[model samples]
Target: MNTRLQTQTAEKGPVSVIAGPWPSYASFRSLPERERWVLYGSAKAYREALEDQGLIMAEGYDDFVRRVTRELEL
Candidate 1:
């Protein structure tokens, strides 16, 4: 888990920590198309986070892409 983003039951927690520094999704999303794009352009992290769920299909997708790439090159 990201230490910066972690929560314990006793503490006030991560949501308050995050909302102050960054523009929350609700605010930025209402802007014009170019305005929204410009806000997203200065990104420090991806919009979607991939979690450590221990899922198997990620390896399957890697193998599939490599196989297709090799076939296309040949």
Candidate 2:
């Protein structure tokens, strides 16, 4: 099975270390360093990653987007 191991970070801090099946790891790695931070994975994995970093999660969907946007900007 295809798999990828990736790390994503925001301006404020490290975001996550993600591991999962991903067919596009090669393409993803080819991206510029600045763009490599944009990783994709299951929502459950993402939520767990964020929580592992002690980030506060928003219960509402809109609020979650806003929170992520704001955090990434930091």
Candidate 3:
């Protein structure tokens, strides 16, 4: 098995750390910087990839897009 997967399996339990591995970037952004790094460090590759793509969509999909649109002047 992959080392990463093995580590994850070994730690299969209540996640004490609250960080960017959050469900969404909005959640990650809501957290303090230290917490964000915690999440980034522990987040699954898929999530990190999405974040890298600059494709964050907060809970309310449409609303999040609208907000980004207005904020970015896009």
List the candidates' TM-scores in order.
0.28, 0.27, 0.26
Q: What lDDT, from 0 to 1, does candidate 3 have?
A: 0.42
Of the pair 1 and 2, which is ahead by TM-score? 1
lDDT score, residue 72, model 1? 32
lDDT of 1 by residue, 1-74 (tens): 32234333344333311211323444455567676555444331232222222111222434534543333331
* Tens-digit lDDT track of model 2 for 9-72: 5754543333332123344555564554464234336776766675544255465444444433
List the global CA lDDT of all models.
0.36, 0.45, 0.42
Distance (Å) between predicted and true CA of 50, model 1?
18
Badly placed stretches (over 4 Å) of model 2 are: 1-58
- lDDT tens readout by residue for model 3, 1-74: 21111112243542222122224444346566676555555544654465455434233435544543333333
Model 3 TM:
0.26
lDDT of model 1, residue 61: 38
Scored by lDDT, model 1 comes in at 0.36
Pairs with steric clashes in candidate 1: none
